[model samples]
Target chain A: MTLDLDFHSTLYLIGLIAVFVFALTGALAAAKRELDILAFVFVGIVTGIGGGTIRDLLLRTDQIFWIADPNYLTVCIVASVMTYFFAHWVIKIDRILLWMDAAGIALFAVLGTSKALSYEVAPLIAILMGVISSTLGSAIRDLMIQVKLVIFEPEIYVTACLLGSLSYVVLSHFGINEVYNILLSSGAAFLLRVLAIELDLRFPS
Target chain B: MTLDLDFHSTLYLIGLIAVFVFALTGALAAAKRELDILAFVFVGIVTGIGGGTIRDLLLRTDQIFWIADPNYLTVCIVASVMTYFFAHWVIKIDRILLWMDAAGIALFAVLGTSKALSYEVAPLIAILMGVISSTLGSAIRDLMIQVKLVIFEPEIYVTACLLGSLSYVVLSHFGINEVYNILLSSGAAFLLRVLAIELDLRFPS
Candidate 1:
């Protein structure tokens, strides 16, 4: 049976999950750098909300999502603190974090595209926004830690987001049900990411 | 004799100068890393516009300044290309670049504060935005190049911007003329930055 969630609620659920997972990845990355607790929180918060903040700004939304609802910021801080204290144990479950990150990327890709579409932006720019929202936060976090840029990595991260966003746009154009559209798009992206991770996919430099 | 330009025109002139100087610094940083031409352009564009972009996004402006006016992007690209090709010569004129950067910081600080006040943001938050606009672009560029954070350095950069923004707000509150407000605030910041650079002033860490 298909899920019965409404459109806005579905978006909210996915967005919250995306924030948590992205924050976890940010904290993990900071842990690798041996940064202080404050640094962990800083990187985590930036990575968690950075993409959506950029999207909201571009859309000229009256209030940024996190600023309007402080709960998102709280989630980021709590996740970061948790990660900082248990980094050693968390590192042991690194594979799980990778998969969670993949899921987060898929969700954000669709959400960003949908938000842009609602704003009546052109479809092409909407897709770009989706890719940007899914990937920019992590990229910024990587920069903060002085690591090699993730966008330049051989992995199929941004490509997965692009395809997912494209799929969502096309499905919506055809008047598909929102549930089916999200599921198909997110599934496609998630599968691509998982395959890339397992198969060691690399783009030519 | 006092200058006769309107507030808006003067702001535009200072903004253009700020973008050019910031782009130059970004290119110089990229050159030290032996980055390719694309990387040079990328860093330069990001450094030149990143702060204002952040400010505009936070204020929920209808269109980002550079996107609405392609001239800003063109300036960034041309400045980046010039710096990349003449990096050796550019490095030799490092003293001039430093002073120019100081001027940029001062101008951006005032501009950022004024924009936020126009949006009716609280004075305290407006002051914070001013500091962010003045310093964040270069900070991001430094991060991309993996250098120690400039804010962490004892150079008093943020402090100078903070004082400048505060001065502007206070002057404006007292019904000072826009020209005088801009000049006094910018002069204060520029002088402070020049002193810090020349005296090797370091804040106690």
Candidate 2:
């Protein structure tokens, strides 16, 4: 089984999209705090690449993704600055923001899981990598601004990513086709997230 | 100059000692919050290895130190649990805790700097890595517990790390002997931190 150049590029596209969405969410959160513009940018960048940074570092990649391609950082900065200036309009679409964030989680879950699998790490660690990739950015953001931890909140967010990564890794082990593996896995994650949002799902009290 | 087996062993010893000290601080912080025992252990582990974990990941080491050697984790757990059961006595020795934390910072500063320089990273990044390695564990602990951010509190903490790492890297570049490099660099950091404690130093308001 050989992955071509196109496969790598598509993964890159997914990663960039996820980073942008996460960056917007970060800037929005910072805006709510009425912090200065620089704070918005800093928080945005952290939210944008924080997970992937940790992921790459954990996997001990030769070059950090953002360091190798500054576009990710640039996107985060641009998105944050734009949101800082136009948060009023962005806030009007809070419903869309929720979905976009879900998409971001799904995308990052796939990316993190695939990266870990590529390193031939244990499946459990791969699943954990996926969760970390999807969640650490926002967790750091909430911590930085002293907001209640979204993960610690009785939400189904981490579960969605875990299922997504689990599905992908399991399918791969079962000899599924590569393209279908990604789609089905990410779709599973995104669907669970959507359900959680629409139904206010959470861990049982 | 080629580093010998003894040099590596010495670093391992320093790292273990530093991890123990940081773990004690983390457990003490959690004890103040009066959280459960598990929270104390969790926070202790985070505070114990958090800085070195980030440093290794950023440096792209082949294996994370803690993952490669679970002794570090064992030390953190032991330190935290002991602190949990012995908080009253520990609080009576608050003055000693502050100095022990300073020692941890200085030791980690040297460890972080030497690792980066071993990788031959640029000086600016080496200094930053040292600061991150020495401070990030405690920062994560503080953020986790939602105390006043020791780093952001207009204090001289980070500056001490920056200077400590700077001295190590600069001395290394100047062809200083390895033993002197380690001692002087860590000493510089520890001295500055001690001054901050005794004098209540802060950056200009």
Candidate 3:
């Protein structure tokens, strides 16, 4: 089987776009903090790249995403610069940040799981990586703001990623097309998260 | 040879102490930022448990440190509480914080290397894990404060841990006593870090 070079490359490109969107949401989240531009951009960069960086390190990838692909860095910087110039505009879009975050998480969770499986990790471990890759960026953002861990919070954040990874694994085991598996998995995660938010679903205290 | 159950049992203890040291340093650092007691304790726990947790997840170990040994959680909480009440006093001894951090790094480095080796990872991979274990706590602390990544900085932090792990591998190849290997490796890391600070040595630009 010729390596699905086109499909794999598309995933990488999608990942970079997700990074930009993630950074935009992060920039808006920090708008009220009275931070200087550098600090704002720094937080944005961290929020955008932190999860994948963690995933790469854990997977023992030879080079991390931004290190391997400077395009990711370029996009993050551009997004951050845009945020700095248009903080007021970003602040107005805060209402949509959660959905944007959900989109980013869906992309990350599916891609992370696929990457882990490609590395021949156990399915369970791959699923865990998926959850981590999705939640970790937001987790880093919250930690920087010194908030409680979203992983332990009431939301269905990591849980959605976990279920999505499971779906991918199960579908792949049943011989589903790789691209379709990823799309289905990411869609599952995105819809789950959006529904959870809309319904105000939360873990019981 | 049968696995050394005694040494295995004591490994958790070493990890526990490292967590306590990490927590205390993190709490002290947070206090300097004017964070409240809850924030200080949360920072402490994150600093304490973050590294080992990352290492474990990377190694696919089901038992994370705080999960396997609740004593570590207890230790982290206690250390946080102690630092909270005594931060001002401890800050007076701020000269020692770096050294304490270095010591914790050294301990965790060896522990992490050994664990990686036990999992049959390549020596190079083990060395990387050793460095991650040693430096991950401080990296998380820096990220929380939105500081530039120390790994990207000129600091000799990760370098010292790598050198120590290399020493361990060399000693093991030469059939040195295991305990001596651990001690020598850790001691070397501590000395190298302390000397680097004193001599103002840094990673070459």
**TM-score-based ranking:** 2, 1, 3
When only the first chain is scored, the TM-scores of the models are 0.94, 0.94, 0.90
Error of 2 at B200 (Å): 21
Candidate 3 local lDDT, B1-205, one digit each (tens)? 3456666566566667778888887777667666555456556867887888788888887556554445766687788888878877887776687777777788788878888998999999998888888778777876775556666778788878887888887787799999889889989998998998778898878
Q: Rate the local accuracy (lDDT) of all candidates.
A: 0.85, 0.85, 0.78
Residue B193, candidate 2: Cα error in Å is 18
In candidate 2, stretches whose alpha carbon ends up further than 4 angstroms from where it belongs are A1-11, B1-48, B55-60, B67-139, B148-205
Which clashing pairs does model 1 show?
Answer: none
Error of 1 at B102 (Å): 1.0
Better of 2 and 3 by TM-score: 2
- Which regions of candidate 3 fall more than 4 Å away from where they truly are? A1-10, B2-49, B53-205
Over A1-205, each residue of candidate 3 has an lDDT whose tens digit, in order, gives 3468877887787888789888886676566576778877887888888888878876777789789878887887788888989988877776586787777888898888888888777676677568668777777877776665565455777767777888888898799998889889999998999999889897442
Each candidate: RMSD to true structure? 6.6, 6.7, 9.7
The residue-by-residue lDDT of candidate 1 on B1-205, one tens digit each, is 4356566677787788889899999999888877666567768978998888888877877787775665677788888999978999999999999899999999999989998999999999889989988888988887777788776687889999999999999999999997889899999999999999889887887
Q: Could you report the DockQ of all the candidates, in the order they appear?
A: 0.14, 0.14, 0.08
